[model samples]
Target: MSAPSPAQADTPRSTGFLLLFALANAGGVIGYLPLLSILLPARIDAIAGDARLDLFTITVIAGAAAASLSNIAFGWLSDRSGGRRRWVAFGLALTAAAYAAVALATTPVAIVLAIVAFQIAINALLAPFLAIMADEIPDSQKGVAGGLLAFAAPVASAFSAMLVLSPFTDTTRLLLIPAAAALCVLPMLRTKPRLLAIQTVEKTLSPPRELAIAWGSRLLIQISGAVLSLYSFYYFQSLGTRPDLAARVAQVLTIAYVLALPIAVLSGRVSDRIGRRKPFLLAAAFTAALGLTGMAATRDFGMAALCFGLFQIGSAVFLALHSAFATQLLPNPQHRGRDLGLLNLTNTLPSLLGPLLAWTLATPQDFGAVMLVLAALAICGGLVILFIRED
Candidate 1:
């Protein structure tokens, strides 16, 4: 592979493109976070009652499978089609329809099927949407772009809080959430980006080995994330708080990510200037592990919340920077969409693995064992990254 031309390497994207791109990604977050974090489990519990945990596990597993396949398929398809916006628009429509299905589902079976459909539709949107970042944004800007990606968490979390605190019924909340996501997505649809193309006479570097290592590391870290995303509300309730209070606690935890925004942006900028990603990645991983260890040892609500906040900050920074790092590692520019979809396996696989771990090691009343185990996995993940020699 040839090195990027001087002009390509030096040019930066406009602020307008970056902002709209960030909002588009935020739309993806808004579409799913509230559903998975708050609404899905609540709906399953309502219908499943005593078997809520079992049903929730099943739903997540099914959804994960669908997400895994759909992301790869859509990504490859987008690569073949030579465009992204149409696919994204089509995905957004499908996602909206799927959300409506979820809202109307009243039985366990119906809910699970709806969730599976939702997963497929959403991944279709996300797969190409993510590839767009790699396709358009210059490498010089990816770190800052990744930092901006952190904005999604707070935006989505705020939406979740609003849904929880609102007087609307679950059905109404379900419809409203996706509607907001669609609005966020619309602006980017109007703009087109100049796609970067890579020309190579022969491969110059070993990318597969490095990508595999990075994939494994992300999978390990994301397992902890999946567990928390699916179970944090329950974990809070297990601490003896009432349902409403637990919801508030989860929302308060959003503050961690909010604070992480500046840290991530600054770290990204520094990494861009210094051209180093591993140190920040390693530090963030260990910081998250430390927070998890703290959470495992503490039972007090206040202390636990603080520890979780710490974990959030670390994980948020790691994920944001990792995005930039991973894009730089893509082996073939032509297959970026497909390659990124492959990378997304790290995200989806955790949903399957995390649920299994939580099921085996945790109960409705206790999550300490799972936290300790997750901390260990996080440590291992950080260690794996050490083997990747930066280019």
Candidate 2:
């Protein structure tokens, strides 16, 4: 979107608009994440069998490479065009088509191509949406907005997994539901963008050192959390359970997320009401570290889920606050799309790294090493947050 004029920047949005935006975001999350987190790996294993890891590795590598390029390119395009709504609509349409192709593909090559396409489409949707937040949401409500965005993930995860994994074993429904559900948010995509009032703050970026620390802190914690979730099914199997038990892992994580939602949303509301972000962010980081430590120390499924739930609660808090905080730190209000795209790398690039880290540190025989590594990274993420000056 074009740089908001000073008047546009000061305009206020209604609560209804923000709620719709959050729901729109949830549509995207529901569309992609279940496929990414659960089904794709299973599908890859089905196709590649013994070579699933090798092929899955290749798929992730290719998809991440595509995502990194497409995210920035699309953000630049949206900025140049001075519009985001059309791009978002187009992305949803394209992703629906891609999901259909994925469902129909019998060959590994075709499936990988479909996945790459889906990644590009999803990122196209995401980058512009985030830019919209920077353009429209006032600073006073950013934490609330961020909490809404954060709230979508778990709600979507639980709903989508139960719908796809439990009720139907057919591939068509698995793919088609995401395609259809994505359109649920299309109503929110009105022709015009609503602008938000700005709070008193510099429009320019924070100091380079502060920005770097803030960015790095999120990067480290996200890598750890993403890896933990991405391979959770495998992590379940490693505990010596039956193979069928893998499907139940999503349900377990769903429970964790369900438990985490209140804590995340309430923490965010409290932060916004009190005009503080750093303390909550730091608390989340340290709490995540403690939870990860417990996850590493236990092998029992019940105990592991409890620990993982604790981690999820902390992660939910951190992610919401971090996004709100990061937007405030953007270097150029004129380039919010481009800048947020770069910052979003901290989200996508971790998907690429998490697998490699898992491969190196966690073997089938021993998953604790990866958990410990994540714990340490989370601690580091917390420490770095100490360096950023919010005021």
Candidate 3:
């Protein structure tokens, strides 16, 4: 292992810094997701004809494989090097290049390759950045930081929708703009040397069993959410039978997430004050289950939107706290980047499972069965969390 560079050492923390950091991470994530969630499926249909679903599934499978490998590998490297800024900077630069590649892709194979590259680069960006969170944030306030981080998805989704609806219809601009936004926050990552006497000590390491239980619980809920999110545009298209209307419905669904952002942030803050994570996480799971069930039972777009909004609120709460709690559960503070990388398996695993589950259970006309499966998973996620002893 190389000696610690001056840049790898611990830096001073501030509220403003955390905010900007979260924003940058969110921007980078949104850069690809909107295209993934909104544009890619339709684009595949245009390029590949009747095999669009197969192409979408294959691409996601490949991307998932890439994400899983890259996250853990880069995380291990970051922990060993004790650095975040350089890796993030490199990731942002690589992500920009990958997005440009996506913009130029003319075939399904080309698009899939681009997507894989993007996923790898994005994971590289996220793994190191998340490690920085584990390194810097105190346990008492991690929920607050997690809440701020949770805002990234909704905000990015909403922004993506707006871009789609705008006159800038070029895929190049759509991809590049968010890439630029991601890089804009790079200055926030500047680090200073660690002071040897200062140590973060509020939270003890959680038991391995407890951490595993929490991981399982969170993984199921994340899979459920992934199923809903990845197929939302297609689901709406089936309902309306008009591409434009489906896009509009997808936009509305994303707005629900944006509206729920406050609830997510508040839930984290409240959880911090109460000093409890299990209850909020449990409620999040149950709420998502209810929403998934409601969506399955409803035919009306309005009703479905309401249901999905509920799910969004619940999911946001769960994910925000999961971030904080997962960080606390790390067995080795020195290896936090690598450990969190393992925890991130929960996130990437769903990209594989969610799509496969949807392909097996739901056709374009029969999302109800898939929704039921998702609801069941959400319920199970909540139930599993009961096994964890917080102490």
Candidate 4:
């Protein structure tokens, strides 16, 4: 560990900053979730018809590749420039513009191009924004911060349900989602928190090895998340759900995430207090695996929904705690932005792997095989974390 830089030593603690930071995370989720999970699929189905899956796969792969590269680039750029706020604001503007382009797209090719642009813009926003947490939030508070971060999913999911259920036109909905994100983000942007007060600490585990293990664990887990996020709408349809019930499905997703909120917050707080994260992380992984396994074995819509809720609870808690754990393992404070960007690959790379897995094992009507595979991966992710000798 190293001494705090002068700027870092000047940082102040404020509940307002944490609240705004969580809201900003929700804003980021809003920026992408509704678009990727609902709107984009709907658009592709409208334009590509029976071939929507093929087009969706292509578009997602392209977007993921763009995101993978752009995240690292923007993170490094923010690090070099010694600022994250301006880059994030610029990325938000670009994201809005890209959304407009996506709305105006009339063909598959055009949609793919627009999605690639959107991915780049969104990652530019996400990479720097995440780095801000590592740069400022104290280790003692990171668990609570990660717990707060869990709020983003339900907020975004609820917004997705609203967009689907409302009588608003697709174009109007597209416009409104980004505006809602801006409202969440703007408050954080307006309030500048002072830098973090970094302190030297004895190492418990080698940072490089711990980070590598954490990265791999997250990548394995996220493959399932990426697959589910992109395919849940289709999955519900496969359960013999009426086409008009998309909003209902979105509502179910919202409820699942909402149910996970308290558990995530409570577990995170407990982990912080106990100075232990692995137990919660392990429990979350196995719980998610159980849910996915149950989902694979059942075809009943009600049962599947219940299982999905269980999975959401597990995934949410895992992500929240793992985030705090990983931040502590970051090897270099000075390069926190860039290192976190590298970690972002665990997120983006899954988009690629997930599609490949889905294309190979799943059809428009059958997702059971893919679900089982995902369950196995989640278990493996949990097992991988055991290799790390960290608290």
Best by lDDT: 4
Query: After aligning candidate 1 to the native by TM-score, how far in Å is the CA of 153 from where it should be?
Result: 0.4
Per-prediction TM-score to the true structure, in the order listed: 0.96, 0.92, 0.92, 0.95
| Cα lDDT tens digits for candidate 1, 159-253 | 88888888999999999987999999989888855665443211333468888888988988899999988998778777885747736764765
Q: What TM-score quantifies how close candidate 2 is to the native fold?
A: 0.92
Which residue ranges in model 4 land beyond 4 Å of their true spot?
1-12, 198-206
> Quick one: ranking by lDDT, best first?
4, 1, 2, 3
Instruction: Give the RMSD in angstroms, all C-alphas superposed, for model 4.
Output: 2.9
Report, for all candidates in order, the number of backbone clashes.
0, 2, 0, 0
Q: Any idea what lDDT model 2 has?
A: 0.78
**Model 3: C-alpha RMSD to truth?**
3.2
Pairwise TM-score winner, candidates 2 and 4 = 4
Worst 10 residues of 2 by lDDT: 1-10
What's the true lDDT of residue 319 in model 4? 92
Q: What is the lDDT of residue 219 in candidate 1?
A: 88
lDDT of 3 by residue, 262-311 (tens): 88788888988888888989998999999999988987878888898888
Q: Scored by CA lDDT, what does every candidate get?
A: 0.87, 0.78, 0.78, 0.88
C-alpha RMSD between model 1 and the true structure: 3.1
Q: Candidate 3: misplaced stretches above 4 Å?
A: 1-13, 191-203
What range of 10 consecutive residues in model 4 has the weakest lDDT sum? 1-10
